[model samples]
Target chain A: MFHRSPIQSFARHGMLVLLCVLAVFPLYWMLNSSLKNESEIFTSSIFPHKPVFSNYTYAFTQMPIVRMAFNSFAVSIMMTMLQLATSLLAAYALVRWRFRGKGVIFAILSLTWLIPFQSIMIPNYVLVNDLGLNDTLLGIVLPFSVSTFAILSLYQSFQSFPGVLIEAAQIDGMSDWSILTRLIIPNTRSTIASLGILQFINAWNEYLWPMLIAKSMNHAPLQIGLRLFVNSDTNMWGSLMAATTVSCVPILLIYLILRRQIVDSFVRFGIK
Target chain B: MSQSLDNTIAPSLSGGTIIVRRRLSKKKLRRFKPYLYLLPAVALLSIWMYRPLLYTFYLAFQKWSMVPGTSPVFVGFDNFEHLFHNKSFIDSIGNTIFYTVGLLPFSILIPMILAVVTDRMESKSKNFYRAMFFIPMILAPVSVSAIWRWLFHPSNGLVNYLLVKLHLIKEPIAYFSDPGFAKWIILLITGWKMIGFSTIMFSAALTSINREYYEAASQDGAGSFRQFVHITIPLLSPMIIFMLTMSILFSSQWTFAYIDMLTTGGPYGSSTNIYYEMYRFAFSSLNAGLSSAAALLFFVVFGLIALGLNMVSRKFAFYDN
Candidate 1:
């Protein structure tokens, strides 16, 4: 299989290796910078002479780093739960039911995906304020909880699920809710897992919506917290990098744990 | 509540009414069952999603900030009419297109090449390279931006240090701060972050292609490059078009967070795109009317561009299994 002509293979492999390095070196630089002192960071060096833990510790104490992480976790987890429940139900109804306006409703919902959040930022701000949800965690969690992409993707999966399962459940005296919980949810595990991870990642990376709605440390997530660190601009590169690394850890961990599922989710959701 | 009682009461009195009641009950069970299943989603999306959308439209025609007592005054199309003549809005359109133009090719082409090459590698090596490239795509954009910001730092940044060390430049070059280079730098960083995603997408698309076609091409004396151009490129067009459309749609928003973090479209708003301009108009200036109008304008223009691209790409995209 490795039978390409030597010259062609060399150029191909050479270019591939070059692109990989280009992609990964910045991450290496960040990890290295997080471990280096200011003087060491300025100097040209491959490795830090003395790795320090001060920056990591400073990132924690100086800002509301822990609080921000907690907020991100709480809101992301809640939003994910809400999303999973809502998306699963909506997908099931959309997949199984022959409602009068189902097609039109699905089309309308999908059209909302094209309406970027920028267009609605001010209106959302006003709505959030009007609903008395502004400056609160609920404010951030609520808008993000119902994702159009998630519903549609899950609907795709649910559409493919055999309908006999639900029919059998109904024959066995099962309510629609029980039929959904007992039948559809169990069968679509992989799709659910992938869509869940996709939604989780999007919610975690969200910046503008959270920034607009959430105020103070009481509700700000990791992205906003990281923004504060950078903007604080104490010329404190070490602390900034450390905070960034900290914020990245959970998602990176999730990405590693479910690498294949995450990749599939990206393609499934058309995120890539 | 009383309407429901009236509905129940009217159908229960006559023989035809009893038949209607049975039919209605069955129909209600079917229709209401789906609604029950969809209740949580419909309620949440209505209040949280659709309400914001409608409210945004409402605010587009009114001048109101977050102030408590101030009443919103409807300003008709003045905000939008104002944006038509506004230089920043026009400049933002140019800058957004500039950013997308700068980022779209690198995002699509480089990754296409990488995936093509990686597909030719040994399975073990392919897995290695895929994992390495995908590591960044999995990380948060905030982390990616922070990493690139440090890497692109003018004096102490590793980029300049490497360039000078390689004897390419005699002095440290300002990357983000320079007005001329800032937008490009932002685009480059955005493209870099996106490269892994596109590469993986292409790789997945590549893996789906049968090996027999390539083997046949090779048997027919096609060179690797020719095989790539004829076989791989044509085959991979759908993924390419999909990525291209998405990248164009999101180029401004993709860099929005980073721009907010690093530059805020600084040095005379050289890096400001429509997305950032919308944020600045709303939050920074507290001008909700102008922001909403700008947002509307950006949507109409961008939506048309996306629709046009979608139409063009439909011709070239292969739907082959």
Candidate 2:
């Protein structure tokens, strides 16, 4: 609030409103198309002439939309938990202990983050294949069981935790495990939760890895399943829209509910 | 107690004699506790990331067709030599450069402007605007592609209808397959998804800028624009540069799914980047050596860029605090 004018306000909000429409137009289009029939979908209409639920029904019943969505949800949950557990424990140790090679460990982890996962795609696929884990959810989640980014972000958060409280817990004859559970983790719950949500969303939105792993439609996550649908012989636009809409609902809902925490999490950990 | 026990043996030389004390060994278990906690993360990274990385490097030199029970033959730099002459590989590198440079405006410039313009809005309005912009960033890439695919559909898409109604063009363009438009469309979609992410980054950076600087600038007769140049630009330069680097590095990756969905590197390999081209080499062509060679090339080029960026950004960062 150093300066202001009514003209500036109008111009600012007007621009925002315009950009807002542009940002949301495609999603609005997807929803609108989902409500249209086969002939209606082929027409040049902004609004559906005859809205129908058959597209959604066909997507669910004829296709394995539910199974795919459930698969995504389950895999994301497993991935999030595994990543958080490993990252949290490691971050706590790295932060609380004065260990040899601490700086080396930190530098190495960040380096791993910089190396593009694409480079390892072939080897990871080979490893998973050789292990006979292909076409399984475990295969999809196995390679990414630890996230360097998560560990780094948690390290930063855990660094800011007050040392006196930790010392007090130690003086009270508490083990390191007890001190973590009783003092540090409870105090850092919000950070953990926000990071967990991020990891969860990342896992849910993962496309390339799951697509590579799930060699068939039966084992595919929502994104892979969506791809298979598009690649299928039938060019069912309405049902494709419906399937996409269904696939997006969980993430969209998570975004809707935890908007503030999500934004804060991104701010805390730079968007990758 | 350990110190007292040592003091009893030889008061003058206790410090040197305590070096051989076995009693201190009792705490050895606690010293390894940290490593115990770090085991899972370190082990997992070693197996999944570092091991595969070394394997990719090794595989780059070996010629193999991925056949079961077959051995790969060491072909030296033949894969790289072949890549140099290969038309698709050459085109993909050019497109990779195209995507990296193409995303700067969306990832940095536009977001910087949006954040500065709306920096002073009331809380309700600010959250409303932020929420709207962030919609695309959170959507799955496949979902985003599906939505864009519908909008740009040649026959029944809104873009075509809008173009005709406005008389911008007489006929609808098959934007994805047309060589003229495919790469540009991929760039556009990637930038669209990316704008919101960088906008939030800019907004957070802006809020962290101390309010006193703006007030001081105004007191000294600087207008809003002048304040932005003198104070805001200096403070935000680090973030801007960081974002610019990130976009340049990862923009092609962001466009990958869209390319796979819309173009499949087609109308005759017009839109394919290195990642897709490599994927094609690995799976479709089943040529592991060529694919690994390409992957190795990507890793080295980007790794050097990242190291260079770390030094440059560190030197340029203007921390107000």
CA lDDT scores, all candidates in order: 0.80, 0.86
- Sliding window of 10 residues with minimal summed lDDT for model 1 chain A: A263-272
lDDT of 2 by residue, A43-144 (tens): 768799889999999888756887888889889999999999999999999988988889888887988856676778888998899999999999999998
Which candidate number would show the highest TM-score if scored against the true structure? 2
What is the DockQ (computed on Cα atoms) for candidate 1?
0.65
TM-scores of all models? Answer: 0.92, 0.95
Q: After superposition, how far is residue A157 of candidate 1 from its true place, in Å?
A: 1.2
Query: Worst ten-residue run, lDDT, model 2 chain B?
Result: B17-26
Model 2: fnat (fraction of native contacts) = 0.76
Candidate 1 on B63-84: residue-level lDDT in tens? 8775777877999988888878
Among these predicted structures, which one has the highest lDDT? Answer: 2
List runs of model 2 lying over 4 Å from the truth. Answer: A1-3, B1-25
Candidate 1, position A199, lDDT? 76
Q: Which sections of candidate 1 miss by over 4 Å?
A: B1-26
Model 2 residue A200 CA deviation (Å) reads 0.8
